[model samples]
Target: MTMAAMAVLPSRFIKCFSLSSASAPVSTLQEIASASPQGVAKVVLKKGKTQLFKYGSPMVYSGAVDRIIGRPPPKTGEVVLVADGAEVPIGWGLYNSVSMFCVRLMQLEEEASREPTCALNMERLLEHRINAATDLRRQLGLPSINTNAYRLVNSEGDRLSGLIVDVFGDVAVVASSAAWVEKYKQEIEAFINKVDGISHINWRPSVDILKEEGLDLLQLKHASVASPSQVEVKENGIRYAISLEGQKTGFYADQRENRQFISTIAKGKRVLDVCCYSGGFSLNAAHGGAVSVTGVDSSMPALELAEKNIVLNGLDSERITFLKQDASDFMKKAAARNETWDIVVLDPPKLAPRKEVLQNASGMYRNLNALAMRLTKKGGVLMTCSCSGAMTQSGTFMRVIQGAAAMAGRKVTILRQAGAASDHPIDPSYPEGAYLSNIMLRVL
Candidate 1:
């Protein structure tokens, strides 16, 4: 940023933002100062786009940028200051040259004033944010005797955008999506390794996402060595075999509360769990005294794990059975045979990863829900879920379910509406982080 523009900002703000004087470690201090000796690069925003970010939106899209001002242009994964049209510093963030998200704002001007030591110091900021996240989970009573698997850092929710950390037993799986996170992989690992009860760290990079952030795929692969292939964890007093290489961070800890709810309502009920990854809902249902539980999935490996979990928990295999079949196919045949269950749990994978495909995905969700509803006995309960952030953020998932009920010739009333568990906190500024819509309905 130019000295004249810097002059326009408050004196206190400037002092707190001065990288050279930041109370950071010497090595990190030198890196920040040397990276931009002429002062940090400034990302000038369009006139009308300043307020959204000023009001605490973490993502600074390329479309919002009017122009950039710096002697040597800032490279991707570098720290840069974000300024308004008149060149007033609104915040500072990690810059990306190729991605649609030009900048991921780390802290606002007010935040810097409060914690000046972290200003322009990514290392210090990471430590502070991660420690705070760890403390928050402790406050939420995570890693208790009954549950040791849960989300530790929820990307934007934890103020660490493009970074998700799920802790399972003694291992922590770090999912990196942004170029900056990749750049600071070692620093992140070092901090996470220091967390209590964590003995191993697994680095899982989002290949497609990093590619969009202008990263080299080959280098990304060698970022970290392999961690434990599998981990045994307990959730809601139930044992689970978590495969690190399975889906996103292995187990679906976000649905912990929702699964517990299933157990509560499964007593004496015949429960059918569609797209049951690793038999989470099915196991809960069985534990809750379900007369019979059927778990269906397309993944053979997932089903294998699910079956193993049934044996692990010492539950009656005859009472809870798993099937390897497509969700729609199983529901269709069950409905055709006039076979219905007392409760149906449909937790589909992300059907709409992006907003552009939401229209097409809605049809898929509707069809699945219609089939699920059809296979539900009269007055039976149906717990449906959509992990698509686009669908959940669009606020039309309920409408789609309603349309599905109309198609199935069934009347549905919502018994409950929920999102991810408490551990997966959502930042109001970034509602996109709010995925996993779990709605319970009474089908008639």
Candidate 2:
């Protein structure tokens, strides 16, 4: 499909746009022309006998008729077809003149749009998504364990693109990276209020993506209410005190099942949780009866939270050590000190968000995994992961880890391959939704 054809609009609106062809039933090329005072005629579209000027003259669509007859095409602003006859604006979206996907639909139907402004519908969708996620968790029998933390809404996975809500205990951190969601701030806040068992709501907008979308770099418009700053949440019988204002919904819900898997094999072994934000894996290891657990992270605040979680779980604090240092640097330092761990987890943040940086990100992953392998004792477990959607193919991640192991002079045996927790379902058509890849390997 051409970029213009892929533009965001409800199927209903797009269905109304008919393409004509000379040899075909009707001419599809309505018109093509450059829109400038001195520019030549480029392209044009025809509706009945009226010839709608397109390329040469500016594209204009009447708000009253919902028809693209004559007017300058929108360059940067959003496209809104007036409700005329059978045509209606489906939802709000962004439009770009340069790219083929000139229109990016933000919502399906304006009336069905679940923004913060539409409290009733927003709450309904939130409840629907939460109930759906909860049903999957129950069907999986995860409730038999003591864990309560899980993903509530996984962006496009829930058909709510650019919105992520992770529930930790009674608190929910709503992260909106797209302007469409941000635009409905009030509706979101109101919906969050109606949810049962949720007392606090914190909003975190992915500013980086917003900037790329040509949006203003600003703080979260919705201020957080007075909620518990920290609370103990259980995961697979492992306790963790999550901070409401912490990164990516406090704990990494994507790796919940993977952490449990690592714990099952952590009995009586020294485990290192590198880049252990809030000590998800470290606590799991200790709960699984690991001999020792050392959690390393550069964020002091996160380390502090991890410490609280360790105490909350009634685990031996002496057995769990928190280190404030860069994960890669800590691994190198541990190697220098001859410190070895029977199991090591290298769950780093996304190194590459775009495909252009795949090579550089792969190199970084290779270097980190190499260090992780070096820190692992012979025949030890190495649980490494890549949450970058850009590294979509499993082969790409496997090759990088294999290369890293070879550099560390260790042959690796794949024990188990994992992915995002069940709540974060992957659509068959959208492979990008399945971004998290967890591989548990035994270094030989």
For model 2, the superposed segments whose C-alpha errors exceed 4 Å read 1-145, 217-220, 393-395
TM-score quality measure for candidate 1: 0.92
Off by over 4 Å in 1: 1-38, 223-226
lDDT digits (tens) for residues 419-440 of candidate 2: 8988887655446577888888
Winner by TM-score: 1
Model 1 has a clash total of 0
On the 0 to 100 scale, the lDDT of residue 346 in model 1 is 96
Specify the highest-lDDT model's number: 1
Error of 2 at 61 (Å): 20
Q: Candidate 2: minimum summed lDDT over ten consecutive residues — where?
A: 26-35
